[model samples]
Target: MNCEVYKGSRKEGAYLFVADSKSLENLPAALTEQLGDLEFVISFDLATRTSLASADPAEVMASIKTGGFYLQMPPGKDLETC
Candidate 1:
């Protein structure tokens, strides 16, 4: 698995690249363990044109305040190099 994280306007959001679907399924757990101090939520794709997975920035931050984290992995590069 390959993962990179960037600080959002309010909290930490991670972008993950998994080699396959199986890896993707396990991503949440992997991230949770990696981000020891912070709480992690679901992953989002910024590049997504649809609103299916869209999340409010304020809500994301709010979740973090409660010890939860949010993740976003837009479609682009492969996890191998990311």
Candidate 2:
């Protein structure tokens, strides 16, 4: 599926992937707080990705499928790695 990627202002190397810009409005409150400001990075076809630098494609798809968004935390942080 097509998706947009946003980087969290409060964390380095952290990324938030959503179905579209509209999805940002539907993110959970706690998640928004944790992520702080968001900066649009890039938009791409997620359905064609086989691998990512810091996250598993299948897991990211699962989150996006269930939550309408995916939080890709850095290699080591407070939450689970995306």
Model 2 per-residue lDDT tens digits across residues 1-82: 8889999877777789998999999998888877789999999888899997887788888888898998877656754333
The local distance difference test score of model 1 is 0.37
Q: What is the C-alpha lDDT of each candidate?
A: 0.37, 0.84
TM-scores across all candidates? 0.27, 0.86
- Candidate 1's C-alpha runs over 4 A off are 1-29, 32-54, 75-82
Model 2 root mean square deviation, Cα atoms:
2.5
| Worst window of 10 by summed lDDT in candidate 1 | 1-10
Per-residue C-alpha lDDT of model 1 across residues 3-57, encoded as one tens digit per residue: 2233223223334222223333444665545543433333444233223344455
